[model samples]
Target: QWDKPLTSKVTSYLEDAKEFVPFKLKEVESAELINKNNIKTVEWVEAASDEEEALPDTSHRQEVTITFIDNSMLSGTLVSDTPRELSRLSDCLNTKESFIHITNGERHIHVNKNMLLRVTGS
Candidate 1:
């Protein structure tokens, strides 16, 4: 991570890199962000009533739940003031994109928006 803002561009990690792994959202079935214990099962809540305004913002990292089109959900933490392009679930939920990038600690995941259902935070 650089000191300045990092946009959600297809990066090869090297500035002068000629080729990078193209992200084909349509072809991707599922992806996972490497975690400490590699736990993939996240408890799916049928209905979460925690309002965004009701949640305290004192904590830099807020708990978030991302529900996909298949009804499967992933519970993770997100930075309070994340960038716009990467802040779909935080800054503004109105802007729907083709993917949802989530950062949980050192883990980073990009969930295809076509398959994304809802993003709930608390």
Candidate 2:
């Protein structure tokens, strides 16, 4: 009878559904899995070349006033023969700090090494 075959098909469908339940539970447990000891550790590395080139020595020593765009001034001894770099500006003026002050009439402002105008003998 057609009714007998329909009942057999429904029974096989329930058996397949039962097999899928364990697979769904395994997927949920796998999603919650964690491993704590797999973290990466970093180590510090030293440079291969430790020696650097020495700076050039200069003899033209004189007091120089550097003026910024805002008319601030800085007076310091100027040493030539050194390369014109931002970091070397402090050493060229023989100053320990990064900035210097220059005066423009009644107002005074701070200037960096790149604002130099001329170097005259003190």
Candidate 3:
């Protein structure tokens, strides 16, 4: 870890690096043991794309209630480029990616599928 610390999301660890590939190298498991994680979820307070919001008809947003594996629950909105892009709530959960994007106003919360028990009502 750098002496000068900075917060990062799932990716974007090296803020200044030009060519950054997440998990490009094989890291030792012991490194994680040294780093105690208090991270429950990775939530980003950021702006949504200008174009997406500008075209209201083209934008697809869905509200969902998630129950985590730990039995904690939350409600969030999922926004996508188009409904066909991710047609249904089930499709979002079944996507190849491990993380699903849920928006809370300007905030984007990427929840890991591994931590989910059941996700409903989107």
Candidate 4:
């Protein structure tokens, strides 16, 4: 009996199914609003560890030429004796206000604690 075809009942069943599933656009808009505010904050916290590992090690000292914004140059062995002094000098070099350019010119280079000692050594 269930397998028998019913042409009159088919139309009524299709109409009822269509009425039950209604489209709501407001739900999609609310979801987008919530995601936009929360995603950036989550990404920033996740990236913090990678940022710390990328930092350079300034414990070891090396010879570098210090170039002032005025175009003057100073060549000396970078004194990394203390962490504070090394940090201060590194900040100065990294800044656009004062910079360091490493090079060897005809003039002799010198390294001193308080002053720059440069001579041709004639």
TM-score of each: 0.40, 0.24, 0.55, 0.21
Model 4 TM-score on a 0 to 1 scale: 0.21
Candidate 1 structure, TM-score to reference: 0.40
Q: Which one wins by TM-score: 1 or 3?
A: 3
- Model 1 lowest lDDT segment of ten: 7-16
- Candidate 1 lDDT over 1-122, as tens digits, reads 45322322311122223323222346787653333222223222222332222223442455778887778987776443345355554454433333334555445554544555677888
Local distance difference test, each candidate: 0.45, 0.36, 0.57, 0.31
For every model in order, what is the number of clashing pairs?
A: 0, 1, 0, 0
Cα lDDT tens digits for candidate 4, 73-118: 5554442323555455545344321112122322222221222222
lDDT of 2 by residue, 11-106 (tens): 233323232221124546454322212211111222333113111243333355655445654554444443445335445556543233332333
Q: How well is each residue in 1-122 modelled by candidate 3, as lDDT tens digits?
A: 44321222332332223332333226654322211122336675654443243324554677988898889987888645445766677775675554566777666676766778888863
Question: Among all windows of ten consecutive residues in candidate 4, which has the lowest summed lDDT?
Answer: 37-46
Model 2 residue pairs with clashes: 73-102
Clashes of 3: 0
Weakest ten-residue segment in model 3 by summed lDDT: 30-39
Worst 10 residues of 2 by lDDT: 36-45
Instruction: State each model's C-alpha RMSD to the native.
Output: 12.6, 32.7, 9.2, 29.8
Best by TM-score: 3
Q: How close to the true structure is residue 25 of candidate 4, measured as C-alpha lDDT?
A: 61
Q: In model 1, how large is the Cα lDDT of residue 105?
A: 45
- A best-first ranking of the candidates according to their TM-score comes to 3, 1, 2, 4
